[model samples]
Target: MQIPAGPLLQTINSPEDLKKVPKEKLHQVCDELRQYIIDVVSVHGGHFAASLGVVELTVALHYIYNTPYDQLVWDVGHQAYGHKILTGRRDNFISNRKYKGLSGFPKRSESEYDSFGVGHSSTSISAALGMAMAAKYKGETDRKAVAVIGDGAMTAGMAFEALNHAGVADTDMLVILNDNCMSIDPNVGALKEYLTDITTSQTYNKLRDDVWKMLGKLPVGKNFTREMASKLEAGIKGMVTRSSNLFEALNMRYFGPIDGHNITKLVDTLKDLRNIPGPKLLHIVTVKGKGYELAEKDQTKWHAPGLFDKITGEIYKKKFDLPQPPKYQDVFGHTILELAEKNEKVMGITPAMPSGSSLNIMMKAMPHRAIDVGIAEQHAVTLSAGMATQGLKVFCNIYSSFMQRAYDQAVHDAAIQKLPVIFCLDRAGLVGEDGPTHHGAYDVPYFRCIPNMIISAPMNEAELRNLMYTAQLDSTNLPFVIRYPRGEGVMPEWRRPLEEIKLGTGRRLREGKDVAILSFGHPGNFAAAAIRELRAEGIEPAHYDMRFAKPLDEALLHEALLQYEKIITVEDGTVVGGFGSAVAEFMALHGYKNDLKILGIPDRIVEHGTLKELHRECGYDAQAIADAVRQMRKQPVSEMTIPA
Candidate 1:
């Protein structure tokens, strides 16, 4: 059953409808909006906490600014659910993050209200500034561009770079600093401390609030207060706290440290700020999970807590008696702790994903060694290289998609110098629901061509353990990349002793004469399932787990080509310049012209869906593998023979 939006929210179909509601009644509207989000997310399951944090801000922005004309860019966009709901998508909001349904984040194609599409963090300021500059160029001085970025996102180098550029360029832009003091995990480093110091200054907040209150207390209210009481504020505040010189130093007028949930105050502040000229900053403090007690208590865990009971706030979960297979990330977290415990040189680094990547496990065990670098990917990579130069073994764990940010650092500092930086790339394939920007499709192809880089993907938990073990061996020197997928691993007995795997070698699972299927990473498990079905049809094709994409196992590949009539290479990465492309290149170079088929992500963008659905669409699922083999066998191509 579909839940109805509250009376105030029901009247709102667009921002135009939102503006019709009296300013005094906006709090009721925010309440309705927040409930609607909880109701829908309780059933449909999408990002929860971030959107909940910005309910009042979303309402205030739409109510104050002329959206679709005055641009609004949401940084990272996880918090844009409320923005989406207010902008004619309320009816379809329940379909958020579902396959072929409403996208979880703001999308330009989805709505005119979404001025810029966003998924990755720290792009909003730049995007909004560009729009602001474009509007100025077009002589539309009345229009405004606002970027609502979290304090966590503000820690990124891109955000600072944009601030530096925008400050000098003098773009008419507003940046909303949503300080919740958390991003997936509790934020780390100097910026976090700085933001915390501002928010925690009891004297500063009380003085600022009292000044605004005193302005209202004057018989003439704010205008009169600004005229006369401004001197008093300057006099008192100067004695108490250091001024907010941070945003001002970047040449943007900063106004805030205000309560985010106060809809009336938000509206009033926004109304005032809209009239201001040049770049401006509004620092609004919000709790990550404001309305809900459970999420507020444990914000990081609730960031994207799957499906949950809305009323009780209990996550819907299955109880299992049998030991469940650990997620690839958990295995990594546990393995790293074990490795660091044994090897004194082992150190871990992550770019603000201590909890998400499970590096928190190692950080807990060895706080000094495991470092959280606070949304700075390029810095994380270079820091690892610097550490590696000092003969320390560094496991630089980063999301595969996020590595796109630090590619240059990886090439110059790690690969070129042959630093033994163990790059454990989690989420290396289709990351379902988060969509194209978050997909780990490009990492394999992007890094494979880099010299002195060893690219390896494990087929299961056991192989992943072995690969991590093998990479950390004292003999290892070159930079190594271990790519793995998102979900649970197949091996329940994954806690076995870590054994070193021979580099550039593959293990054959089955033997056949007709065709040989080569697979890399977790996709080999899919191939194994297909092999069983093929055998049931008396189609016994051979299977080989090609562990490494960089150093192609020419000996094993030659062995397969000599035995089989055809060859098929499958990977979860892109077909263009990926693992499959590497295989094709090697086959052509060696003059082994046996009929070859490459299967992977097609050379186009794939939208959000379940992992299995995406795999099937990309034609690498078990059924797709079976169909490919059957089709290849039916073709009138002769068996490939080695040029002996």
Candidate 2:
């Protein structure tokens, strides 16, 4: 139980240093790295179990491959912490997933070793393929390309697509399928069964190896002998295993259901494969939470543990520091549970974000009413649409960025059919630490353009709760979307009780004469703060919180135009086709001569940083808004400062 100090981890600063260490000392380094991860994550919560599971895999890959020069892409990037520690990031691991610190996922900008950034699931194969193909095109044959994807990530269709392409291209690439037999939840589908079949094949490997050895002794030409060996291996594998030869069928060599935790086995197998020709797949069987007994015992809860006692491995609980109610998502969970209690037709669905969306509470309260549909966002959307047709009130909760995956489903199935399904989009803004891929910056723009969809952004938890209730009870015969930001809701003394706000209407939070600022969703609160700051400068700017994005608040907007010469629109989503664009489009059509400015997310992929940093970068923060307005008033049209 004694913790090792300093120089053990210090000497191993990078992968090169790791290579110099004797093989015998690897277990010691892994032990230290695992304990170090546990210590840091206990204080600053993050994806724990995943990193722990891949300790040896990380070590093996770094030991075998020339990383940074050779490309290593980690799918979903949640399990790359161990890799990070081995690749010169151990010192910064303490600040992992925290505000203004290291990201939870692999970031290309963070280090040279992280060849491709990934936050979404199933991107490793495609990214690795790209790097491999690029390497081939550039004639860089000396470098290796590797993709480490999870068994859960393998379920995604994109992963299969990459596999199919990689197999046919005959590119020199290595795909390590880390089969832990779980996603956030237990994996589902025919593919999962196929993998189970492959992993459980008792005699397939034995017969194939025996046949290869026999073929090795044949007195034939080298090319013919190699082709015959491959064919014989396939024929023997087919006879013994009825499961589809997915990778082999696509023309890639397949290896293992090997022991993923066995560092020696992993390193040896990788070393052998390094000399092999063409595309290859290595299926490594790993446990999700490999080391810590508590994490191993309850993999799901420990997937991302909060501050916990190292001895008992139990999370440390504390009372809330604020007098405010629970988060908007938490409130939605409670509300849905209550609604389901009365209406048996109610069902809750989430696309692999049960905990983040607060659907876990509902799942616990009424297991039948709530369901986790894995990482299939598109499937979840249409599935909800299917349930709605049966007269069921389906509440589909997903993160704002994730809902992008279901765009076609939203348009084709739900909106087109006008199903009464409630799409609750959580984290609908610049999510901190997780960065660009995880940001909820594009949902408003993406969803606003779709027909038969009513999108609303609530300012506080009470409003969010009411919106959910309203969406459920509305006989409008259309799909409804309620988007909210991550974390706690704003505290206000004059908070109103839950009530249905009229569709397409906006409430004037503050009345002023010179200018009007129209804000949507979470940014509305910041707009109000900016207004107060403007007032101190004798600029009494008006503030209006638009509840609905789709409806456009034409009446309120028209009224504002009549009273004010200058207008600004602010939202948390992209300005391209979002609330600002909606306002600008309306003003232009109406031939309003007033000068206008729009504020929202920019039209580029942002990187890993805190929400505050992103907002400041995008000019969505309160001080940024105040400065933008002040600058706009003082300068001409060409000289006015506008968000990029």
Candidate 3:
């Protein structure tokens, strides 16, 4: 199934090669590239609509800029697919997001054209500014730094911070605001509303056009320079609309609300901006799914619609003979709504990830109670703390990786105040295909040391429901964390009656003779499977699902330690300072010198792949666990030493 690129696209191996294509043929190139993306992604399965959206812009940027030398940074990397294809990766494009293949995002190691590696949002402006500043310092007068950032990413405070500095920095940089009105979900907040107002206002646009026309006609040599033009533009903006545009007010010359899909227009606009020095912004309006009709209608669903029928416009799903368990996120979404219905005090908050965290369910049912705080993770945490001060239970749902952004707020605002903020950390493991930048690998270690934080993980959906039930109770008055992995849980019939799980407790799932496997979170299922496999080989190992990492179940641990001679701890998080480390600490504190082994994500950058592949690669999958037990069985257990 070799997908053929358009004849024009086939000629482009790099931006240098793209520069060779006649300007008239760029539209054909865009069409070919867009069609190629559709053809390959329909079968290979990577991010779909975002790449499709930016095809024209990607071509325009490469054509105008001397890339690799001239730095170009993509904010979140969702739209970098077209960029990659144009830059010598056309042949290997099918390997996108596959195991041991191309990264889904723009990666610096992967290509010289990828000036900055990005996975998280709202980082492009700052990163590009740095590159521009470096070029200035190095006296590279002709060099330019361009950042392609989305409207959704603009909602984050970090973007504003960078814009504030970039305004006065006097650097040769361009911030291309890709206003698609979406980032996985629809863009929210005042910024979104402001962008809408700018794009929609006929009066503003007409005046803007007149101003641009007047500025264009001004003399261009020594008498009238770029600075003079900038000042004149600023003066006109101040006099007419009181400088209504946000980017203009930041002291950066702002151009556009231009048609991003018009390849010629984009090329012309970018060429002109390259000559106009200082920090500037180009606000180009484009649809999230520009060429695809189905994607344009339903942008969110088509964002990453995995292995679709491109012709039929049907997203493929694996047909199951029996009912499969729902994703943990969906369960969280429904359960949070259920909890909100029961408790008037319960409110939901997510940092522009209501849909991702499944809090969208609650948002739909109780709009006022649940909020999408744009891309402001810190604001979400602090806002949750504020609500907690009023005795309201706020479940601040965030992706485990994204929560790293709000660590300060979690510590200073919530944990220090001991606000009973229930932090539901979704995708709290090696999230498949997203790679290291998105893996929820450090949450356990990061949060474990914080006092007044009750860190817990659920073994399955029932346990997750129970944990949520417990965390919201008035009796539970700590900053609670319930971290769960991505994708489906083990139980199909998981809509169990919500019951409160006692704090600082664990349950022994299986009782065996010599060895005990201490498991945490979703990886408990892996441990159970390994135990089953070992049992078939006439080796029975005990298993315990220790729900809480912060508060070790000393009684249960004591029971296991006394009976079992060999102990193995398993967690989806990093072994360093994680649940396994916590267990090791407990063992060390009590002076129990039993044979111990820890299995989890090693302290290294794990690349993108399927969850099963990552688990096996990290040596914690069922077979790996079973192998560990068998290896331990072969060696006689060391004599256990306990303090009297």
Candidate 4:
């Protein structure tokens, strides 16, 4: 992709510069902005189509409203790339999602334009309303707060919760419902455009003002004219567009189903909405990947295609030096498809991550069995539990970070009920580039305290399959969790014949008498590499792949404690309450005193980078583990230090 020759866009460093541009020339500016985004993202590889989808909306909002003061809170932040670019990050946008660079999502610390830091979806409405209510409390009655939420994000319960409050508060705020996929009504045509112009005209405005004044006078009667005025507005809106009972029933003044791409119409609507106040919801219909033809056709795949040619729209084929193993998500997708073929009770569920989790394969193969539950994680968890009660083996796939949203449901609905819902947690460790909010760093520790839960992390693709297979057996009654990392599995030929790994058990990969290193999940693979280096130095260390974090291979751990008398536990998650802490509790309970050290992510947030970089920072990389073992052996365990 060639750099966009954005003459107008080049001069506009910030929204302040955007305000200086003539309203009539905004369309050309928008075209240049969209192309600029394409040029940068095609090379840099951040969120692609989402930013493309909301170009005109972003332009119109910034052009119409006074941002950094009026405060436009973007939902999810993927669609806010245009907002970021217009708000003075355009020149530095190439470094987006890079290590210690600009965050992919909206971050409050990054810029003042980002009023609310957003990474998780559907929090925009709640955050915006809080700002609105705060503005009201501080007596800034004219301050405007707007939430630009996607139709996909609206499926979450939190969005509705905020709407429910905003509707009743009668606060002067706007909720822009960005309907990019599903349409409440067709885009406003020429006829609707004429009606909108007439409604905004001087003669029509004077007539409406006269009618409102007369109604105010009739308000001498108790609750009469106020009710009549609402009915009048509803009746008028019913003829103009589809009457949205959802937003309207909550007492929000509903106005739209407008053409989001039509910059003239968007500017007019937003300009009019500024004066007409009190909880208004303007539903604008937009096409995802509007300008880019290829992206518009396949919005989902193009949502975050790593690196692609801007002109041809072809994803750059990664040339690996060696044969590449499939992603862990593909392993889960294929394994579940295979399992479903064998068992009639097998079913799949994902909360808006069918494709991301690779469950879309099963979705295509068995549409009846597999379900895409939208962005409702809490509902997805309880729904799986409900399915489990009916004797169905539900394989509910969710990202580890997303599962944090449904933690209560996992505990109350699944664990407390002792339901056999197989939770397939993808991205169970440091997910690079998405940054802190997206890192899968807390699943093991979070679920450890819950009863009737079995948390297992597989070291490779084969263990993932066997563990998944083991969870489906008729004997399995408890809620099972199988967590694996984001990238490719270590094993290339991993789909071996299904084997049942015994519960509460672990397997030894290396043999030693001096030091025993027990590792869990994908981090155990690092220990494998570390052991190879140790052996080259004629110092062999026992390496145990402790598969289950919950039922910690008591018999194997007991034997290791007696034989080696020195131990270390490593995991991909935090050390505070994670796998290492579980082993520590076991030692405390049984009174087995061995010189022990724990190595994993420390008690702080790990930033975005490659897994190798992050693993080294957390002191669980191959070299770090080798160094730790040598230090533990040479010095006392207490004297040995691990990088935080």
Best by TM-score: 3
Q: Name model 2 segments beyond 4 Å from true.
A: 1-8, 94-101, 200-244, 306-322, 365-369, 389-391, 416-421, 491-498, 529-541, 603-605, 624-644
**Which pairs in model 4 have colliding backbones?**
none
lDDT by residue (tens digit), candidate 4, 190-229: 3234334533445444544566577767644666755578
The CA lDDT of each predicted structure is 0.90, 0.82, 0.91, 0.85
lDDT of 3 at 465: 95
State the TM-score for model 4.
Answer: 0.90
Q: Point out the worst 10-residue segment of candidate 4 by lDDT.
A: 182-191
| Model 1 stretches with alpha carbons more than 4 Å out | 210-239, 638-641
Clashes by residue pair, model 3: none
Sorting all predicted structures by TM-score, with the top scorer first, yields 3, 1, 4, 2
User: Alpha-carbon error at 84 in model 1, in Å?
Assistant: 0.8
- lDDT sort, best first: 3, 1, 4, 2
Best by lDDT: 3
The clash count of every prediction, one per candidate, is: 0, 0, 0, 0
Summarize candidate 3's per-residue lDDT along 107-215 as a digit string, tens digits. Answer: 9899999988899999999999999999999999899999999999999999999999999999999999999899999988888887887688777677778877887
Deviation (Å) of 534 in candidate 2: 6.3
RMSD of each: 2.2, 4.7, 1.6, 6.1
